[model samples]
Target chain A: MKISAKEVQNVAELARLELDEALTAKLADQIGSILNYVDTLKKVDTTGVPPTNHALSLSNAFREDVVVPSPGTDKALANAPLKENGCFVVPKIVG
Target chain B: MTLYNLSIHDAAERLRKKEISSRELTLSVLERIAKTDTKVKAYITLNEDQALAQADQADQAISKGIARPLTGIPLSIKDLICTQGLLTTCASKILENFVPTYDATVIEKLKAQGAVILGKVNMDEFAMGSTTEHSGFKITANPWNLDHTPGGSSGGSAASVAADMCLGSLGSDTGGSIRQPASHCSVVGLKPTYGRVSRYGLVAFASSLDQIGPLTKNVKDCALMMNAIAGYDPKDSTSVNECVPDFTATLTQSIKGKKIGIPREYFSTEGIDPDVKNSIDQALDTLKSLGAQCVDISLPHTPYAVAAYYVIAPSEASSNLARFDGVKYGIRDMEQTELVDMYKKSRSRGFGLEVQRRIIIGTYALSSGYYDAYYKKASQVRTLIIRDFKAAFESCDILISPVSPSPASIIGQHSEDPLKMYLSDIFTISANMAGIPGLSVPCGFNQMGLPVGLHLMGRHFDEATLLNVAHCFESATDFHTKRPSL
Candidate 1:
């Protein structure tokens, strides 16, 4: 299926990526080509096969709940570009 | 001995005999890196002071008679591994200055074993590309031929070891990140079965397919790394709890009657280079001479690997990488008038174009209108690919093939076409899809004098068997001894 310019913009918006007008057209062409190429999966018969979300056969490996003071709030926030009041600050979501 | 050339086994042995201090060895590798990395561009970050301090402590430990498999072995870590107080960028602009607060589980184990941390090696951004060209910082050139690309996203790890810039390095193999480079660079690289190593601090590219293993110069060193890093990790919910065998213990076993599989599917016409085919044939001949029962088998769904991988890996990556939004870690723009704008601006400014393309494509695939048609359908095909291996393995002890379809391509050959770039992982991704063990050992060099990696695959969590097969092959061949002409 051809990816419309509108769809490209939607995906770009959803992915939170900034795109110039040139890039938007290039992305449309590239993604359009990719989608066209990837359509080969449509030919395979996978009626009885169960989808594989996890590659390993095992399940339910969990760490016990225990308090560990590691990479505390300060350390976690250290990589953030902007912060305020011990929290990552961002632009207003609500008007 | 050059620190870059010494295997972990040899380094540890020499250190125990007091032949060389860890400080001396660490400095040697550091100096080697200093001299060559200007052209190779293998290392992204080097901790000279910290490395020397660790080496001194390891020397002290050895002086006091402390013993461990990795002690006093200075190894490079792939940039993907988290190093506390050091940048772990995944070689992407997105997390350019993001220093992880905690060490990856492998890092912790290496430190505990007294292994010297030489530095972090470069790779394709987020382990997404087969060639290191996808990296945002700079393309890592192959040690064998600077004009050719180093296969990646573990290209730096493989190239560094190949050039003797570092003795060994840890690399994640979601789809041949470790093995392909090892093939291109003529080194030994292993991808332990999925869940063989913990993923707690690894910036997850794909949860299911990702497994961290060492890229080393020889099989014995790969075994040493497998032993230390192959245990169950409670931190990662998917970490397998099966017992990790002392992988190095079976190094001397014979390979007389092991049923080695040669899948005709691999040799079939998907553009297998003649040199690779010759090397694989030579490899099979050597194994046959050593008493291996070779048989033909089929993994008919082999063509589906790239398609399924692109869908599943990117789908998972889209989810895993979502946490990198500027708000929590890395770069976040404050000047945005709205929160959504802040996120878009940060990610757009941070991630490279290829990474953005993937994130966009992944988000599109997993979106509400297309989830069932794309992500869900691709996943079902992934199951068929897994079953193909499962059936084939039942008829053979281990399967062997070429690590890559072609030898290392020249830099910028396929960097422009993402689909073409993704096909480079064709021969290796199926192993990851099946969550089985995969290894790449230098088989021979092409007419270009570049290397060709022979791939050995085994059943799930069967690194021991794979190592035994590799050891058997190495004992019979001198490919491991061949290094780039520096």
Candidate 2:
């Protein structure tokens, strides 16, 4: 549970976040304390217990494949920071 | 009394009798908001023109003898719930100006009832923190004491009701978000069972734990709001297909033989304010005098609730928030030279510190080496916590406890310590972890004159019993009648 700065950097990179040395060090301590506290779960016996992702027991919901009208392209793209002819514009990907 | 001070029950009755025009009520509340919002900062966006237009429409409907139950009732919406064409910021800068093209399912329901939406209220960034101080916009103050917080992330909604700015408001509780704020503000707040209310169009937090309910001046208004908002929705898969009951049908029912469970663990927990403990003890006595049996119950896994919730909620948040990556909508970093860099920079800058911290924790928990140890372990522990409730409910009609360990803390009290802030949710999180309905009703006040809340949690989809118990208590005491003078 000892979260190192390197570990914070690794996780931040995976999460697509750029953390400075100061924030990374701070997070290292914060996350370390949190994880250390959660380590108490290790004491519980769960030899054959199934994990519960949701509180209720629900099965896969099915629906017809029929098409329905949605917010048109214009409205859908309204909040985009940058947009092209009709699509969202992002930084260059292929180099 | 000013129209702003009228409870939804009384206001709706007066509206039906033509004793008050919807426009008059709307204008009065608007005027009050204009006067007091500077000190409370409860609202994020106030729709004066739109609200007046809606009120006018409601008046026209009344003239035509077709006014709905919520007709002309002005209510505040937590910014996390989508309102078509209105900015729903979730108090995060990332979605600072973002407006949804469509309404949340609950908004659609309220609109159907001819309800007037006053505006979106502030909350913690992405509903991440307990105090509204984490808002990227501004902090909401406790109406009772300006120096203290109106417990959050639904702080603004609770404050709006307590300050008479709105008759009722909608807030989503992921952990203790709704109930805690309602407790601090001394209003009635309920977090309906997961799946009891649809989550469609609610800005996703922890999907499994998030449930939208009402914060109102009294238990009757809470039930009325529930009657309007609680039901099945085909749009949300998790919404229960079971029949929705009339929540108001049994509010006046007697609790002659009702079994009220007192979890010993909740009372014995460290850091429980002595004032809170005293209030809860008095509340139990009040219930006992009302002919209810208070039985000792144990949720043995209670200590693990906060730990399990932090992991499960943040893990789900990491996946849900991954959608905000400088694309489609929300803020985007335009200066980045590359796509990957843009994603990193946009997220790093767009999200607040607490939000980023959760995302980081979630990411680390779900990462390759740690998934089994953290995420999986947390989910398993969540099962145990749920089982603990299932067993406790077997002997109790409803469980009563303190909504919070203490009243609202000072505005900046826990901002520096993340773990300390997380621990404040002890009393309220288990309900969410178990996905049951929990209600917070004004019980008493601390020495500082800050309101304390009595917590009542019930079986899944059993909000009626919880509301009945709260209504009975409110009838027996004047706690719910005490309002903060702004």
Candidate 3:
């Protein structure tokens, strides 16, 4: 359950976050303690128990394939940090 | 009494009788906010001009005899719930200036009933923390004592109602967000059964656990708000297709034969403050005097709730928050040349420390090798927790306990330790895990003069019974009538 700073950095990379050494170390300690506490769940006899992904017993909700009014490009891009030609502009992905 | 001091029901009656105008009520509330908000720090954005305009429209509607229960009544919204063209920050810098293009379903419902929007209120960033201290903006102070926190992440919603800045407020609860703050502020708050209220436009935190409900001055107002917002909506796929009851109808009904379950695990658990325990015992005695039977029951998996919730909520949160990659909306790091670098820098800089910690924990738990040990194990434990509640409810009408382990603590009491802050939600988290309706009603105050809340939880989609029981308790106690001298 002990999460080292290296593992913290690796997880941060996976989560698309960049953490400095100090924050990574701090998080390593904090997450380690939290994981240690939650390790108590290991003691519970959940043998043959199904995992509950949702609290309510719900199935996939289906709706008629009817077209509805969208928020439209103008409204959708209103909060975007950068945009051009009615679309969001992000950093270059192509090499 | 000052106009701002009127409860929602009282204000609605006065508006109906033409004894007061919406403009007058709204102005009075605005004046109260101007006077008290500096001390309480409840509001994140006060919608003054728009609120006045909405009030005038409500007045016109009233003149035409088209006034509804919430007509002309002003209310605050937790910042996470989208308000069209209004700032919804989630108290995070990432969304500091982001305004919604459409209303959340609850906001649409509130607007449909002629409810006036006072403003957006502060909450922990993305509704993450137990204390409003985690807000990217300002810490919301408990109205009872300015130096103390209004237990959060619905701190602003509860504090605003307590301080008379607004008659009622809307708040979303993922864990104990709404009820814990309501308990601290001595107001009424409810977290309706999951899927009872539509989650469309509510900023996702932990999708399965998050639910929107009301924070009000009294039980009846809570019911009134429920009537306004509770129903199925096609916009949210998880919204239940069940009937929404008139929650106020059963308020006057007797609880003479009601069986109130006293969960032995919650009572026997350590860390419950002496004063809170005393208040709950007295509240139970009062219920008993009113002819309800209190039965001792066991939810053996209660101890595992917080642990299981931590894993499941954050795992889901890590996935849900992955949408905030600085592409569609929210802040973006324009300086980063590479797309992946922008995603990393934007997220790390935009999210706060606590948010980052949760994301990392979630990512680690859901990682390839650790998924079975953490997320899967926690989900299985959650199943056990839900089954435990099912067994307990079979022999009891509802469950009662302290909403929080203790009354409102001083502002920095749990700031240093994240685990300590998470433990504050022990009593309230199980209801969210079980997807049951939970109500927090003012029961008594501790020796420190801070308030304690009596928690009542009912079966899935049974908010009516919870409200009725809370109303019955409210009638027999004067706790709801007491106000802070702010």
Candidate 4:
């Protein structure tokens, strides 16, 4: 039931958060306590009761694909952190 | 005259009457932001020139006798809603300097209505934290007590309104983001039914549950904002096609014979403050006097809502937040060797600690090895939680509960513990999961002088009933008029 330091590191890796060793230790304790609190659900007996999903009893709500010319490209790139050649510029993927 | 305190309705009326020009009102709000925002830290960015220009245009349109419901009302927006040509960071570093090109559906609607855009308000980074303390920019302090935190993730919007920095503002509510802060600041916030307002432009947190809503000083103002913003949008498939009722029409409906349900589950535990409990009781009694009947109902799965919400919300968030990697519009990583490295480095450098924490929790919950037991199980529980609300609604026309377990906590109080922070949303999350309208208004004050919020929830798209019940209650008391002495 306890999320240990190792498990915390693993979760961090899965989450893509770069936690320092000290922060990892702190988070392990916190996550462990939280998971323990969440464990209260284990005591319930769901039996034949079906689990719910959409609260409004809705289903199959999807919009049709219709392309509309977006606003000006200049307006789009006006606030980019870095832009080049009308596309977002990022650091090279392969070094 | 302070432009910030002018109600949207009043501002619109004044523009129509040529009493005060939109240019004057816009300048007033812009000047107020310049004066008070440094202390309130309510806005992440201010669009003074653009807002003033829009106000001028609005004035010109009105001079020609052109009219719209929200025309000329200068309003601010929460950072999460996308605004074209404006920096729309959700108070997170990931999109810190990113400007969106496309308008969210609400933004388009507001523009069509001629509502002036003042700026974007601060929020908890990626809408993760209960207090605006998690905002990467600066902590949004309560207008009443600057040392304390304002509730989040619409903390800045709520703070801006409370401090008279804006007359009306828009906020996104995934789980109490709109209502909690509205309650803390003693303002009126309306979270319309999930699909009642479009989610096309909101940065998805819990995609199935998130909706944009209005935060205003009073109920009538809320109705006017709702009238302008509510309705179907083809872009958001989930946007309801139901007729956008003239919400203002229902304000005068008699609450007589309405069956108000108070879920015993909400008050059974020690989670609510005593003053809030008393205020709710007082409101209930006032409803009784007004000819409404009070009944007790049970949402037995109430306890499981937070557990299921944290699971499903994070599961959806994990997928939604994946778009923020360096390959997209945000800050990109400098060095990367592989696709995974691209994601890792981009995300690491872009997002803040809290957003990263959630993405991690969500990723773990939905990971292949754990999906069956964690994400799937949580989805199953989400169904049951929805069923709980459905079963409760069948017994009452509207449900009443506390907005938060307690009033606003001091800044930095629970910032360190994510679980404890998540628990703060316990009372408000279910409404989002159910995709229904929930309104939070000031009921009374706790011992510490912080406002206590009473949540009123209606059946799906039944904002009329909710407003009527709330309107009736507001008339019976002066709670809505009470303000914090800054």
CAPRI-style class, candidate 2: high
Question: Candidate 4 residues A1-95, lDDT tens each?
Answer: 66677876777677666677886787667656655665666655666656555555556776558777776677766766568898876555655
TM-score, prediction 1: 0.98
DockQ, all models: 0.76, 0.85, 0.91, 0.47
DockQ agreement of candidate 4 with the native complex: 0.47
Q: What TM-score did chain B of candidate 3 earn? A: 0.99
Q: What's the TM-score of candidate 4 when only chain A is evaluated?
A: 0.76
Query: How much DockQ does model 2 earn?
Result: 0.85
lDDT of 3 by residue, A1-95 (tens): 78899999899989999999888989999999999999999899989999998899999999999999997999989999999998889887888
Clashing pairs in 4: A15-B360, A52-B383, A52-B384, A53-B383
Per-candidate clashes, comma-separated: 0, 0, 0, 4
Query: Interface RMSD values for the candidates, listed in order?
Result: 1.4, 0.9, 0.8, 3.0
Work out the iRMS of candidate 1.
Answer: 1.4
Q: Is candidate 1 or candidate 3 better by TM-score?
A: 3
Model 3 lDDT, full chain set = 0.94
Candidate 3: residue B131 Cα off by (Å) = 0.9
lDDT of 2 by residue, B32-122 (tens): 9999999999999998899999999999888898977789899999999999989889898889989998999999999988999999998
lDDT (tens digit, per residue) of candidate 4 on B1-486: 555677777777878999998888888878877877778899999988899888888888898898797888888899999998888998888888788888898999999988899999999988877789988888988987888888998999999988888889999898999999999988999999978998899998888888899999888889999998899887887787898888889887888888888888888866666788887788778889999888989988888878878777877887888777665577766566566666677777777777766776677777778775666676677777777778888889999988998888888898777887898898899899888899998788877888877899988899888877777777778877776665
* Two-chain complex of model 3, DockQ on C-alpha atoms against the true structure: 0.91
TM-score of model number 1, chain B: 0.98
